[model samples]
Target: MNEEPRLSAQDMIERLEPALSPMTRIRAVAALLAGLAGAVFVGTLWWSEPGPLPGRTQLAFAVFTVFCLAWAGYGGWLLTRRAALFATDRVIAAWIGLVASLTTTGIVTAVAVRRGTGTGPALAVGGLFVAVALVLTVRAHARRAALLRRVRELTGPEE
Candidate 1:
């Protein structure tokens, strides 16, 4: 009986390169679009009437916007790198966590400021955000871990 030769990790990766390349590019483009959308949203907020937002609240919003832009830009940059496909699963998980945390912060800040309420509501909302972030981060980490395990199994033990 004749059998096909087993491929080395490098050979397997080479064979898969064509398929992976497009995925990386798509991720990069998505990141860029998200960043652009976030920037536009911030711009719209600036163009709108200031309403009753205090200077401190405005500053907070500006800081949050900058953080959003930075992370999205980082994601795009990371996905465009030559080693993008080789990035560790942990790195991707961390990026997801950062994005979630930033989004939660922005939403909670906006709600708190818009309502102009006492500390009670703000604290409640902040707690909820923290809980949600924790859940998302955990889920992302678990998923990445599973993917890594499957890849490892396919590729054999790491060098």
Candidate 2:
């Protein structure tokens, strides 16, 4: 006897939606702004100060920042395309978003620590942002997994 049942579109939406409230989106946006600001601060220091290996370090940092931005943009594109495609598995996209957030957090943390700018506050804020972003990512993954499970349940056993 087949055990899996077929899932409908509505059922899929119900399973996949995390119901991310408006407040959460706002918080994420705020965090992103703060990260951008931190990047600017770091850039100022990197350019203003003269130290050993300054050119190499600054170049490396610039490249890393650009790469991270590109990664973030790519993640956005993937998400948009996935939405247009009505794709059910969002695990990869969600993880991409998560990685972008983590990367931003890392950049901010590095800048704050390297500059010796009394990092307690920056670290705290960045950490909070990272934590929330991670939580959001996990929720998204859970929703995707739930939908896949529901779909498999509806499909039943195959010969």
Candidate 3:
């Protein structure tokens, strides 16, 4: 009797390539474009400002922009990986939550240090962002847990 040899990793990937839906490709491209657009928009805003920002404000703005760009790019890139769909979605959601939380914290800290009438509105807006971030983080964790259970079922019991 003749038997077929096991497919290598590369062969398996090649076999699976055509099975990927066009929607996945579209989503990846859309994400990549959005990431690029967001980075450009932030850079343009900074460049078009009339005067130089103070050192501390400049540092804060730079940190916020860096985190935003990093997460946007990472989210786009992660979609292209061959990992489980739910897992990738969870990761992207978590990144978004992290970026939002960090940005809100930085803005709130800056406002508190400045300490003026405007601080009230700034804090209010920051608080709203924090609430949204908390929700997203919680949802992502729940989705990840569900995905973990699905993965375990597919793989069966382990020793």
TM-score for model 1?
0.56
Q: lDDT by residue for model 3 over 81-156, one digit each (tens)? A: 6633554565565667667676767677676867754666666777777877777777878888887787577655
Question: What TM-score fits each model?
Answer: 0.56, 0.50, 0.70
Error of 2 at 158 (Å): 2.1
CA lDDT, candidate 1, residue 97: 53
Q: Backbone collision count in every prediction? A: 0, 8, 0
Q: What is residue 83's positional error in candidate 3, in angstroms?
A: 4.2
- Residue 49 CA displacement from its true place in model 1, Å: 8.4
Model 2 Cα RMSD, Å? 8.4
The best candidate in terms of TM-score: 3
Per residue, candidate 1 scores C-alpha lDDT tens digits across 1-159 of 999997877676666563436756676676667777887787678658557777866775676677557657765665655532544533564555556565656666666677785456656766776677677667767776776677788777765
Q: What value does the lDDT take at residue 149 in candidate 1?
A: 76
Q: On a 0 to 1 TM-score scale, where does candidate 3 land against the true structure?
A: 0.70
Q: Clash pairs of candidate 1? A: none
Best by lDDT: 3
Q: How do all the candidates rank in terms of lDDT, highest first?
A: 3, 1, 2
